[model samples]
Target: MTEQRVAIVTGAAQGIGAAIARELAADGHKVVVADLNLEGASAVAQEIDGVAKLLDISDEAAVARVVGEVVDEFGRIDILVNNAGLVPFTPWEKLDFAEWKRVFDVNVNGLYLMTKSAGDVMAQGGYGRIVNIASNTFVAGTPNCAHYVATKGAYIGFTRALAGEIGKHGITINAVAPGIIASEGVLSGPHADGFDYVVPMQAFARRGVPSDIGPAVAFLASEKASWITGQTLVVDGGHTRN
Candidate 1:
């Protein structure tokens, strides 16, 4: 039997976030779908008897408020999936500084702010699980994504450092770095071409779907992973084996 838990999953409007929300709900946790796209978030929440909150994770005030509301509604926040990220992959010569800033703003900074705010709440309650979504691109150092790689690398660093700092607080911080997930973003983002050659696995051969990443997240967010922290669970179907 699974104990009741309340999970807040950002970027839950679609793709991996939606899959994780459904998996968690199936595991018996009340879910709150938080995303910048309010309509999409609400729709997903409605499907699973979850709640939706409009959020721009990049904004500190918005992140704090959303976390507060979840804590207030659920009384305790047991899991947080920091799955929102911006990936703008272009050559360095053509990349815009503002675009790079936006990528970092959401991927690294937003993640830090959410973890900080949620960590405080979970610390007060004495237990919590945080799963941050990074990417295998950082490990392989794939070319043409200087901005994306930097932010995700920062996320990996944040996972390690925060795990050490908050381990004593009874909270665990970990990360999952997926490669070539067949999501809307992956199919349409700047990485579509790159995924074909750089991924080392054909999209039609054995590329990952959102479902492939969901259970790993659920496990990490569950008590089963209590002993694991400061780790990066790579879910790239054996890609980046070098």
Candidate 2:
């Protein structure tokens, strides 16, 4: 039997993050639904018999507190899923420095904070599974998202480099690049408009939903993927197979 592991999934309040949380919970893992929406997180956590934590990933103090609390309660963090991020659709001309910085602040800087804090604990335990949610846009290329794509590109690079440093401690870090997923946020956001243009390009010929990305993340967080590290698994219905 696989040992029960403690997992902290950020941005797990709704959409793709919530789906990932449910998958991990169903795998018999003790999941902590950490998100900006405490109520939503609480709902998911309650349904899964897990826990909920209100967090703003970009805030250093909040990240530190959440990590500290998790370690204190669980004694060790076996998994850390960096799923919280901002996906802004800004044309090159409309994009400005402040907007770019905000995107990086959450997508990149917040991810760093979560990783470093959780990775430090994982290192001490000599085992861990760190899965970052990147984007297939970096590989296949997308328009009106220069800033978002840049951050995801950095995420892939970060995963590769961090693997080299953490492998000695039996910790594996990997990236999951999901294609255009039709989540609540996506359907309500500007990206929804592009579905007509984007869905046909995908080999699946249908809109990829949040659940489609969950199993991929759950597998990466499991012991089955122990030998894998520093790899990018694109889960987009073969949208951008790599």
Best by lDDT: 2
Q: Which candidate achieves the best TM-score against the true structure? A: 2
**TM-score list, all predictions:** 0.95, 0.98
Q: Please provide, for model 1 over 5-76, each residue's C-alpha lDDT reduced to its tens digit, 9 standing for 90 to 100.
A: 989999999989999999999999999999999999999999999999999988999988988888777789
Tell me the spans in candidate 2 whose CA falls farther than 4 Å from its real position. none
**Pairs in clash, predicted candidate 2:** none
Q: Roughly what TM-score does model 1 have, to 2 decimal places? A: 0.95
RMSD of each: 1.7, 0.9
